[model samples]
Target: MIDQLLDRPITDFIPQREPMVMIDKIITCEGNTITTSFLVKSDNQFLSGNRFSESGMLENIAQTAAAKVGYECLKNNEPVPLGFIGSINKVGVVDYALVEQVITTEVIIQREVLNVTIIKGTCMLGDKDLATCEMKIILDLG
Candidate 1:
């Protein structure tokens, strides 16, 4: 599974595609944490005037969490399930990302109950904080 993932883009692991796929690669996925990266570009769906919007930051964090789930599922020979952002709370956007900048996202799973996962996500550009939020992800287990 790692070999397959290594040869494909992040879109292969998550449901998002094309301009909507904010995360470019999975940096690490172990224990209860996941780290991912995305390069902000002019053609990104959430870009406005060469700047990555808050929505993109949120989605990137969510996708980072999703990437971890997807990787584990695939590694275990299970199908990748669909997931949705059920809720977001205590969101803090500290800065904006510009085109050509790479944003790194890290998410730690705080809790899981049935099909719902609660996570604390943070996005950064180098050492500068970009966004942070606590969100609930609802997985479609059917």
Candidate 2:
């Protein structure tokens, strides 16, 4: 069963813990593309009014990319490294995601050189765009 292959929780893929771990699950992962989802809940740490703050949006994007990298490591039987968003550019928030809504995030790896990877990410709530950004992630391979 597919569940047998990906039985580990999303928390296993990223470094963040409760209150900071925003991504709920990894929906798909193929090559340079990864898709993850998060349910915007009333008890979420970033919830403001009915939605998440702009910082929360950016973290979601970064973590999506982190999930991709983590998945790759798991597949290769390597240790999952710590990574941080070194830079973010061209960020735009088109709409606010509300509580009780599920936000799907997708990230495509643009390029990687040495220990840095550049990615383009987008967050969507159904057909509406919530946010998009290009980020550079610095990986700690040690």
Query: For candidate 1, what's the RMSD?
Result: 1.9
Task: Output the TM-score of candidate 1.
Answer: 0.93
**Candidate 1: residue pairs that collide:** none
Model 1 over residues 1-142: C-alpha lDDT tens digits? 4555544578768998776788989888888998898888888888878889999899999999999889888778899899999999999998899999999999999999999999999999998889999999999998
Q: Clash totals for all models, in order?
A: 0, 0
Candidate 2 deviant stretches above 4 angstroms: 1-3
Model 2 TM-score is 0.95
lDDT of 1: 0.89
Candidate 2 worst ten-residue window by lDDT? 1-10
- For residues 66-106, write the lDDT of model 2, one tens digit per residue: 99988998988888999988999999998888888899999
Would you list the C-alpha lDDT of every candidate in the order shown?
0.89, 0.90
